[model samples]
Target: MPSTDDLKLRIEAAIPGSSAAVTDLTGTGDHFRATVVAPEFAELSRIEQHRRVYAVFGADIGGPIHALSLVTKAEA
Candidate 1:
């Protein structure tokens, strides 16, 4: 049961120069929605950007994290 702040911190730490706003969609700590902005995403495709974020969590994505919905953007 990860907190929103924890998820945000993990995403930011995993992706250098990135910021994440994470919300616990169900208040259960299993589902989340994250909007992340990063300079690194500027060159990557949407799928690639998502993959980068998801890679940070690995197996925990399905085990403890349940589902993570994402909206990613390149830094402007």
Candidate 2:
């Protein structure tokens, strides 16, 4: 089970200049909701933005990370 801080670090590391806020939706560490803001998302579609975020976790999505709900935004 990955900690929320760990997940936030991974996301921020994976995407340069990005800010991620990860929360454990459940008491367990498997389910999460991440709100990410990045300049890279400016030109991408919502789906594409999500895909980029999801790519950071790779195989962990359905394995260690049972569920991840994402809310992404382009940097202001």
Q: Report, for all candidates in order, the number of backbone clashes.
A: 0, 0
CA RMSD, predictions in order: 0.8, 0.8
TM-score of each: 0.96, 0.97
**Model 2 misplaced regions, further than 4 Å:** none
Q: For residues 1-76, write the lDDT of model 2, one tens digit per residue.
A: 8999999999999998999999999979999999999999999999999999999999999999999999999974
Best by lDDT: 2
lDDT of 2 at 1: 82
10 residues in a row with least lDDT, candidate 1: 67-76
Candidate 2 lowest-lDDT run of ten? 67-76
The deviation in Å at residue 18 for candidate 1 is: 0.2
lDDT of 1: 0.95
Candidate-wise lDDT, in order: 0.95, 0.96
- Candidate 2 lDDT for residue 24: 98
